[model samples]
Target: MMPFSTSFASRYSSAAMLVFALLSAVAPLAFSAQPADNPQSPVLPKSAADWRHAAIIDIDEAYQLSLENHPGVYDTANPDFLKNLQAAKAAGLALAVRVEDAAGYVAATQAFNVRIHDGHAGMSHNLDAQQLPAERWPGFITVWRGDALYVYAAETGGPSVGAEVLACDAKPIKQIISTNVFGFQGRSDEAGHWWVRAPRVFLDRGNPFLVLPKRCQFSLNGKRSQDSLVWKALSQQASKWRTESYNGEQLEVGMSEPRKKLFWLAMPTFAPDEKQREAYRLMLKGLSEHRQKFLEADAVVLDLRQNQGGSSEWSQSFAQALWGKSRVDRRVAAYGAKTEVWWRASPGNTDFVTGLVEVLTQQKQIEGAQWAKIQSEGMQAALARGDKFFVEVEPALPGAADAKLDVKLDVKADVFGDPPAFKVPVYVIVPGQCASACLDAIDVFSLFSNTSLIGAPSSADSTYMDVRTQLLTSGLAEVIIPNKVYVNRPRKNGQVYLPAIYIKDLEWSNANLLKTVEADLIRRKQ
Candidate 1:
């Protein structure tokens, strides 16, 4: 969610910059300087001497630090947010003996983070921190799907795709998802997001009940199978995964066959780029030219499986082009009534004020043209009165029945445009990888009368987003905390976003899933 920045080095005085550096040491982190609310804040390593300064954090200190410093505990509007933190604190305390090393500390905090159940809040072990057992968890990638654990993709000679796991160390697959996927990962309702991930974490961390042995047992296509996985070096493992390869290319839109009457549009990201934006416009032009063909087509596949996220502007642009100008009212109506969202400025966080202006303008709560004038006036007034300026945002209710305008009378002008929407069935392919703007796209696309979502449940749309990062006192890890809670229905109810149609056969592989969609579309036509 880091916004595209033009070096505004001239904007801040050296004194103000110094204030921010000092404030970072103590100020409460909330929303970062990004509009979509998920910016990755910079995390710097401690002094070289400090790296060797080994200190043991007791259970009491750990719990107290989490309660005070965790963004999930302090920034969320959810009433039960505190209760969840307290429960995790108590649970971690009971297991405090494990906190002897940095790896153990990460496991403890990660468990606490998962309990918060907001995907926006997380901790990344400092690159210098001791590696965890799970960091070395063998090669297989397991995905959790509706109580069943299936091998989606695996390293060569590892578990075969489609293999079902009956148990790990004799615990049922259901228990693994409940305790490890949902419980330990803090994924809340998004089990599919952590299916393949939880197995590795639980096995390496020595989770008391759900641990996986070196030699695992499972069933492949209803036939019993076993595999022995050996520990592989990090460099070797990294190479095996091919992190440099482009997965999106595998799902890219192919040439449209004029006679077939079906179109596949693969959106790799919603992040704003001039070329991508132009490409989007051309796509709209092409679709509009084929109006009758699109209307009569069986389905148009909006591939968003590999999209991590980007600016919401791209999503909004696509929406306007697809539906034409008339449907803007209905689209705005889906947001429901606005709810109060609040934030306080810290002495050093001038960037937040900038971000606030952008968000308010986008939400139509404030006039965009006068944002600079208003911000300047507001700051001067607050300074004169010797008062800390507090900002509040009113966001429309997300996907509710009584949806009404939040602090304004109308939707943003950009939502309505010249290009009309394709009056055909839209199938949005969202695998577990979707988040941020991708989730925002889901919200917009879902409003269409003919749109339907297919694939696994998406990564939990942690409505509480935009991280403010803080370095742990131990210097072993950086806690990424989300400051703003998106005022949406799902956040209030503690739920994850679900697809309209859950595809059972499609595993984690994007290539396999896209092919399945093509086959399903072809089958429907037949």
Candidate 2:
């Protein structure tokens, strides 16, 4: 009836509905029950003294506000979203006993966000007001090693590397993981990534809020090591140590070795500035020049570990350069998932006009005649007639209700460039933390049989994006949330994108990981 197409309907579960709601619309909901912040707002605490002098009520108010505004928990139709909120609430009951003052509230807020486990959902606090854990955990760097938390690196005091960590601060490590959740995006491996900073996870230097214990008790290799923490505000202590900086390069290309026939490329993020954009162009130009060489290389390892995401344009462009001039039928091979309108944007529900325009344009999925009609009718009129528009697809996996939609849209074919597709086997090495555009690369690459994923599974691919930042009613803190939601390939409740090779021992050190992968590549060549 509304330009619906049955061509692609069979691929999607019936329950998927696409809806759009901006975070700004919830400003009133966040502040309505709380005191408003303005020029005359309460003067925020300036230091630890000021924080001590400040009222605990303010911190509580901010914490409550963040909880109410968490998009994953508050307004989403996704059933999993609420479980996070429930977990946080249950954890809060235990935390309440520990919260003594404003600092406690800040810690509670962070714990709340961590429990939610969506990387995009986070709280920003006033750093000057709260005293942060200045020093890091002494000796060993703890990480989630496979299923258990283990000491992956040693700087000074604790167990040797490879020893399993039984507990911390007298609490069993498994118990800690079960009670307090710390992670990124929607994947457990990404959550493990945050755990790698263990005990460090409790320290936020600038936005001093989370606090760690003065000492941690560890049982490693059947022996207990009591590691005492020496706290120093790292910012004040200027040490001679210098860590290498990757500088957020969007696209990096090179070879593992001069003698090796393997090529290496790392794309940390796709959100590029002018320089990064130019660099990507230059990379394509370079690839074009060495087209034959690249095609002839034994294999190409595309590193997507640190790619937190950016514009999809870069992903598309890269695919064109590599895959070149391929045609994909969206109705068949590419019908990964679908979006359904779970909520309408009428006046009774929300600001109808804004909602209609966003739903029509945000996804870029709707086009041709129906899109033009919506445009001609204007947003207000379209809302009156109940017309919905969607643009490009977002991230979402099929749910139980995804199969029953009354109306559906035909997916468009994805057509690439005219260049010769790079026939070299492409190995996508994703050691988790990949999202947004990085997932976009996976989607496009999956179409080719030559492409294979190696290393750890990725952070759960979030179709939900467009993070909206809002200052809390306290003015001392802000909350960041993603207003958009996407559908993804259906997965088990806790499942993630598992790599084909499934390298369990990959470490945080990129150099170490590269060496491991490089060795495997050389063996493959043999």
Candidate 3:
């Protein structure tokens, strides 16, 4: 983490320079420049501001917007409304990237291709997105068999890739994801490549030092396979992961240490009650005091895939103490015009006008990698304002409730200082269980150049608003109504994840998950 200089600043044009500047913090992977699929096709967006508009509007904004414009419309709706929404989304995708600077997403960009029905009683009826013809990255044999593990596709190349995860490192894949895979958890396809992580816990294996890095070992078929796979490193690739007791009680701290300039802290979750505020500070203090230990390693892996995020304030503080990069400053963007309309349209009369009095109207609110980040930044000024500016509205009128309403609000405070430089590339491990404020952290981490998403997608995107209204329905009788967040996104392509890597569960390979990944990483380290 030293001062840096651009080696090729003179060569890039202004636009390219901005692109470079925006992405320089990211890896050197070239941007699609053109959209992933439609290269050379001038499917330009009518407004360049559209993508920027989508990126800044968080779930709070989208939900508030939806309550205003489309009252009471949750995932359940009339077929045509869904149809039109899908159609409009296609147009948006064709017009321009709805998400700008959304490159470098590991698992989010390309993970899940198949969509299953609401019920997943068995694999027979479910669909795996990776099986879709379009999603198959030609030349690989990845298939999520009914068993849940990816096996070799008969047609694509064989499963002869130097390393095949025979098992989930040490633990069974069934055991690793079983607890959280239930329910309407979401997943992505863009955050791909958990294959690179070498941590043995994920692989559940103990490979000899001879089989490191690629963790290649000659298989019974006379070929070799990757001895272990690191799930935490892969979470940044888009899938989320975390470990817990079979019954869901909190697990204890595992391996964390200072080696060669890094401290690989494998945290299980961010449950607020788990550790007192002072305990957290103590851990940070230890890491800081032991900076020499951390600095010795080249990078660090803060694995939190299975981590159910709690205490946004606590999480925010922890992240601040860690990398403390420029994530806060650069992430600020304007709230698009339409966002204002959606806010005022909620079911009730009074709106966020009072709450938003301090910030610019028709503007985007500040968000850091954590929730209530304003408090963490020591911005008592903004915190003082946040406490004062809240909207108290009257009940909705029976007759007027059905129509659309819209309001505009602005955000004017800084919650995070900026994305801080990490002494090492931090690999954020996430699973479908990691969500809400946790997802907020993911969103921010994705913006940094040195992060990766590994593990399965979290459940946050599946309708978990902080404030929800229970409604009447045939099946559940009463349910959470306004809980659904409206992304203004058309239905079809609006699924949560689009990842950078794709992983076939280790059960498919008949290997241990933890041992496999550990063996792989140990081999690499050697």
The candidate maximizing TM-score is 1
List, residue by residue over 92-115, the lDDT tens digit for candidate 1.
Answer: 554444444444454565676666
Candidate 2 C-alpha lDDT tens digits along 1-526: 0011111222232212222122234333423322444432435556554454332433344345445533344343466766765675455434444554455545555665566655555555553443443444343444554466555555555456666666657777655544333421123345324333333332334323333444656565587666666654443222211111111123353334334667776666566557767777877776667777777777777777556665545555566566553333232334444432222222322242244344445546343123223322343453466643232322234343333322244333233443554677788876455555566567666667778887656655443344444555555555654433343433222335667765556254555555666677677679
Model 2 per-residue lDDT at 67: 52
Residue 218 in candidate 1, Cα distance off native in Å: 2.1
Residue 68: error of model 3 in Å? 11
Over 4 Å off, model 2 = 1-42, 45-77, 80-102, 115-117, 120-122, 126-135, 150-158, 169-171, 177-260, 327-333, 336-421, 487-495, 502-511, 522-526
**Model 1 TM:** 0.68
Order of models, best lDDT first: 1, 2, 3
Error of 3 at 474 (Å): 11
TM-score of each: 0.68, 0.65, 0.39
Position 443, candidate 2: lDDT: 64
Candidate 1 stretches with Cα past 4 Å from truth are: 1-77, 90-97, 128-134, 137-139, 153-161, 176-184, 199-215, 225-230, 234-259, 272-293, 344-421, 472-475, 488-493, 506-526
Best by lDDT: 1
